[model samples]
Target: MIRILLFSGLFTVIITAVQLSLNYQKETEELQTISQQLAETNAPSLARALWELNATKANDIGIYLMRIGLFKSITIKNENGDTMVFLGEKDIEAHQTSIKLQFEYSGRTGTVGTFEYQIVTDIVKRKIKDDFIIILISQFIKTFFVSIFILFIIHKLVIRHLNEISNWLNNFKPESSFSPLALEADKGSSNEMVKLKSAISEMGQQVHKHSTGLEKVVAERTAELEKLAYTDSLTGVTNRGAFLQAANEELNRSRRLSYDVGVMMLDLDHFKAINDTYGHDAGDKVLKQVSQAMANCLRKEDTLGRIGGEEFAVITPGADKRGMHKLASRLQQAIAILNFSFLPDNKNITVSIGYTKVSNDEDFKAALKRADEHLYTAKASGRNTFITDKGFLPRIVS
Candidate 1:
């Protein structure tokens, strides 16, 4: 806007200068014409006076011509080349015009004298200066007003809408909804501002759409990663770390509630012998089946985990010693009934179980260690049976 005003001012100045120059030239020409007319009209009379050698009359004519404000000075000289009259100060730098004084006396023309005048250029210059000032002032005022009007139109139609767009961008959020960009001055016309608003609106919508899709994709990926982190690949059961974490949480709750919780460790009996005889594929099949059977035997409140190779653990919340014994017995029965088609008629799968009640303020690791000790005792006694701190189960015939 400032640049516009500056250029407008410059243009006005150039126009004013050109106009002033032309006016100066025109005024100078008009002054020259007036000077020539005055010389033509007054020369005959001045000549007669000089021919008569009347210095007083010639001086009077010179004073009158000077008073007319055309000539700065006038001089008349007789045919003998003697100055007869002079009026006003002679200006050497002023424009001078010389006229020959001739008189017709009874059809005979003869030179009487010469009339010379200097045109008053100072007065003409002053007039031109006044015109220049007036022209400059008027031009400046016109340029100023025109520039201001243009600026106002631009602000109303363009600048204000641009400010609105800037403010909108500052506040825009891709996750949230916003009103579409609109320009009040647009009047629904497809001008530049309207096109800009439409383009920005479309871009914002695309960003929002992509943002939403990206968020959904990120959430699904996070769920998959979480599952991979906590689930056992072979048995499809809770992995060791996740199971221990869950057990600790349950233990903390049990301690606060003053309730008894049970921890149990179970191992497949002679698991290496089964793997050696049946290959790891069969061993893995047996493990998966045994884990599923144990999970089915347990209540919903219990958590089952594959804590090691051929080793499983269970956490039972709000359980008593009798509840633990019943759960352990169910687990044993479930494993005993499992049938492997590839196994010989004489071959069978079994698990040894050990159970313990969690003591007050005991963490899962301490309780699990005690349960593991019971499991070792059960395994040492024989296989295919369960043991607790209080007692051991009678051996079941396979």
Candidate 2:
């Protein structure tokens, strides 16, 4: 954008310069014509006045020219190499566009003193500046609309299709076969970016012979998928990889529909301490109990994933700020009072949760980071709590 803006600025400047030069020359020519016409009309009186050395008549002519406001200065000089009368300031502006002309008249049988009138610009520079400004504004308006039009075309011809492909990639499931991706029949633009997207979409959809054993192909495909399925062996919930994939796909969809999503990260407080004191088996039981407790609090559409060890992440689609608070509170309460009487000393576990609402345009990782930040905030303000814009609180609901 910066580069485009700079280029636009330079273009406007260049065009403004050209427009200014054209206007200046045009106005200068017109001014010269007007000056010559004025000098011709005043010729007879001024020549008679200078021949009789009538300062009054000569001064009157000078005053007439001055009153016209075209010339900055006026002076009448005699032909005897002498100054007859100087009536106005002799100083002229630097690089001023002006014209000087001499008017002579034959009085009887002799040449009279000359009338040297100087005409300076009354509108050339101003008109040049005005032309430059008009051209600049015109260029700006054209550039703005053209830029918007180009962006719209790119979005329709390439960006929308590319986003569609990206969403498919995010939702790719090895266990399922997707129909071939094809572009609609529109030959409006043939850009390389669009072509590359078409190439990527065509990768796995190549037509091949189906003459092999049908059952054998199905069996081999299932086996291959079994190896790639994203599932946690221990908790039986989503593993980290599966969580990211599903969440990313959900995010892409939410963005397209302009809806909000929410994510939460929780750390079982003193999880390592539990393992150190009661052993790995007891820690395993705790993880399972907490996982179940969280699951019980969530809707069917919400996702539960064990990030690793005692850290877990959750993604809830279509959850706004109010929903985010209610959901986070329910999970918090569930985990806080979890019953583990079977463990020694009737041990209970508390979780510190960090959460944030996700917008469609944001990355899942960014939402995760915010959730983790709130998680840290919860942990920092004393464990067994959740952080919101309202600060850390133990129970958000009555």
Candidate 3:
């Protein structure tokens, strides 16, 4: 806003200056033209009237010249230096800075009288104000529209995309492969983060020979624990390890870039009731279906894992409060659309979600706890709703 105002102010000043210059030039030329016409026509007629001593004709001529609205004062005099008629407000002596027109006889035999007039600056300035305002408004409107266009282009092509890429890099891990980002526009762009990941993977393979004896056994055991830590054996999605690793990487990157990271905690609603009513086989089928349904809603860059038997975690890099809410809503809808067939009658599945964002000042762990608290609030308030940093989810009527 300040920039727009400054731009408008400078433009107006420059235009006003040019307008004043043109007004002065036009007024000067107009004054000179009118002086020539009056000398040729009015002066001869007035000289005839004066020679015949006709007061009425001289008075009419004086009044007509005054009504022209250009002159502030008009003085008429005879050859004897005696004023015949002075019809004006000011009575200043005619000298320099005044226009003097000397009248002559029918054929310039002798001088009859002189008409002296002065121009008004205030009148010229008043006329210029209208054009001045029009020019100012036109320039201001043009600047306003152009500024809006520039901001829109910057936001669409630069700001939004840059923030999105920064977030993707924050969530990326050296151990993981380069996956497609969430943004459809970014799908074709092979970013630096992917190259870095490829390089790290190649380096890890080269160092594989160092694992020998105790080192080999320890590595094997560690790999087993890591595999168990991140993946749910039944669902085959991300495990706790995947969620934690991504979250940690995002937090570390966010600290440097000052980008916001969002995380969601989701729990399957009434899963125990489904298990108690049906067998363990039915429960497993429902769990797999629920995970798959939610996964369909997520982007390739997003992380979704079964952290526990009935609870899942999602990490969204580069999401603010609104972004977190939007993702949560989509996941809720995906879960709502699923249908279960193992039961005697068809049943619908619903999940409650909690969401929070890690800002520049926060760590990922604190943000996770806040999200969990909101999740607990969501579960306590109702069974199948989402609670976010903003508030509880609004119920959709449709």
Best by TM-score: 1
Better of 1 and 2 by TM-score: 1
Residue 254 local lDDT, model 2: 87
- List where candidate 1 sits over 4 angstroms from the true fold: 1-65, 70-172, 177-188, 191-202, 391-398
Compared with the true structure, what per-residue lDDT tens digits does model 2 show for residues 1-398? 45766687788788779868877887777776787677667767766777777879878887887788776666666766466766666655523322222344453345455555556764677767777788888888888778678778877777777787787677654445656555564677556656666676666343222323455698898976764577677677788999999999889888888878889998999899989987988888888888889999999999999899899999988876678777777888898787765555556788898888775567789879888988999999999887754442334345
- Candidate 2 colliding pairs: 354-375
lDDT of 1 by residue, 1-398 (tens): 77887888788878877887787788778888998898889888887887677888888888888889877788888888788787778988767888899998889999998888887777667877888788878887888898899787787777877888888887778888656676455453338887787788788778888888888999999988898899899998999999999998888888888888889999999989888988999999999999899988888989999999999999999877767777888898889888999887877788898888888866679889999999998999888878888643334444
The true-versus-predicted C-alpha distance at residue 14 of model 2, in Å, is: 99
Candidate 2 ranges with C-alpha deviation above 4 Å: 1-228, 341-346, 389-398
Model 3 alpha-carbon miss at residue 377, Å: 1.1
User: Backbone clashes per model, in order?
Assistant: 0, 1, 3
Q: TM-score of each candidate?
A: 0.67, 0.42, 0.41
What's the lDDT for residue 217 in model 2?
91
lDDT per model, in order?
0.84, 0.75, 0.73
Cα RMSD for candidates in order: 6.4, 25.4, 29.1
